[model samples]
Target: MGGSEKHAGLNNTKLTERLETAFPLLFASIGCIYLSVKIFNPHLKNKTKACIVIPTVDDLILFASHRAQIAQYRELEITVAGLAEASLFTSQKFYLNQNSHINKNLYTTVISFGDTKWNTQQKSKTSLRKYKINDERATHNYSIITKILKPRYKIVKETRNQKGKIKNPEYSYISIPISKELFCDNLTNGKPFYTDFYKLAVPNRDKSGKLKYRIKFEQKELNEMIEKINFDYEAEKIFIKACHTAWKHRLGKLGSDSKKPGASSFDKLVARDFERLRVALSKSKNFESFRETITDFWSRAGRIQELTDGWEKVMILLEPENWKRGRDLALLALVSYKPKNEKEETALKKLEFDDTKGEEDE
Candidate 1:
């Protein structure tokens, strides 16, 4: 019925009659075909003919095809919502189920539709806006998916007004994928492990529902982290361990006072430590020197004993060739939250920090 004029030109009387006969049965099956009609207008009305058409066996295939297409259309909407919500696990599952044979180069298309105010009398007056985002990879890695879904903004250049400040500073939405490898990597884990990292790095809004800190990694740094991860078991383990250590240092029993630090303070500390470690790793010529730097860093936070427990594995990760990986792992560790159970909480509490050193030392 919605076909173009070209397709309508090809229609014959017999086919048209067949479609006319089938339409009523299709509408009735969906409860859209009304049996009774009444007139509300206070005017003399003429009698109308009620035409009821019965569908044949030939129409069943067409109906089934239409239903399948409708289902797929609805599924596309659900998939788009899943991407926005950062529900990669569910999205991937749905994607896999929908595609019988997975394509290696499949990408998601996300279209955000907006419109200006519409006039009640004139519908054509409205200005429609469409922001299409179609580059996001159709994959199942939390790290990659979170990066894609995370809100990003770029400054729009403007001239300064008479005053020193710009009259209006504007920002535009932007998407920068971490790496091409992330898009191509089929070996990456799709688990929700990155949730803890996001939770630690991006804290909840304050009582005023405003963000107090803006701590986020650069695209280059994120790319390095992804490259280091490489979907390798050892690398993932190291990254997770680093996250655990960071959690213990920042939010565990290592704080300067009884009061918990603000989110801003915590994020700043994590960022600072990450930079310090990155510099140290670059400067270190051998494992021994890097190990000493690591020891010194943890000693300041009263985590020397904890470092000792994992010395062997940590030492292997600190080798010269693996310096970048080590630095990225350190960043991951410093920015991830590892939720602790009662026993783990108790253990953290028992670990003592050096009371002599102030928070400034850390």
Candidate 2:
């Protein structure tokens, strides 16, 4: 189903499915509004020693999920030297709300690369002649179509090759020439952080010299490409996310029918997210009472299994006095806690094999 109309029709039983479908749109809208307000700031730019490393597109969800946790610690601004449109958009939106106090503009210490790369790949491949996006007056165009058309002014090629050098330093708060290599060394050794990025942006032609989005690499090749993106990445400046997919379990190696994501890997990922929440909440003034509520929970609600159940059990468990609004705390415990020496882990591994192999042999 689509939006509200479909949502209104669904019974309580299918609400979870509806939410899973709608999560992306909801996050995008929230993200857009957050970024839109960063324009009219009057304060001096923040020149803190910081960097945010986003290895891939999928990792954006994690950042969106824990944006509040990240905002609490607004560190230095690590210059994103090479700015493609999508990367620029994602970075600006992702890092826009780092500070709680937004009376001034603090995050404008940019190592500016013009929109040439993005513009060059476009149909018209032209930037506006009179109005160049080379100053603080420039606002990021959210719409992809509007950014491309140079209607008011003529388009021209960029005059300079400012790849390894900083351009427009006078306007910059903290201008530092950064290379793709420094953040993640893989790019220097022919292992770029954005493996599929170039192919999508500047595509290759077919045998007939027709533009088609079809580049088939081996499964092993894809694995290597993704692995290379983080080679020698300093986690301090470089944000590393765990592999989004269960890379090991694919269609061929596991079976004709692809196996489900490795259960252990997924559980461990959830454990990490929960652990981060624990650290954040521990500093709150309410933590003492919240701790007492958790202690009380063990006596009142069932074990970790009860905590792991859906919103129903969660609602019941947190409904008591002193635990009414501690759903976040309960969630942390739920994901982190597993039964002692989980039998399911070993049992699944033991059963892992090519189910189709037996049938093919017969």
Winner by lDDT: 1
Q: Model 1: clashing residue pairs?
A: 242-333, 243-333
* The 10-residue segment with the lowest total lDDT in model 1: 33-42
Tens-place lDDT digits, model 2, residues 238-303: 111111111112111223222356433444433333333333333323645555634543433233
Regions of model 2 farther than 4 Å from truth: 1-26, 29-65, 72-75, 83-172, 180-362
- Report the C-alpha displacement of residue 71, candidate 1, in angstroms: 15
Report the Cα lDDT for residue 353, model 2.
20
TM-score of 1: 0.35
lDDT of model number 2: 0.29
The global Cα lDDT (0 to 1) of model 1 is 0.37
lDDT of 1 by residue, 1-362 (tens): 22333244554633343677677645554421111111111121112111111112223554455435434543212222111232233224222324433323333322222222452221121121121222223343443544443333456876688887887776553333222222222223332223222222222244555432222333334434454443434545654455456556644442343336553443344444544554464455566665677556565655544445666666666667655455445544543333355533333223222223221111
Largest TM-score belongs to which candidate?
Answer: 1
Clashes of 1: 2
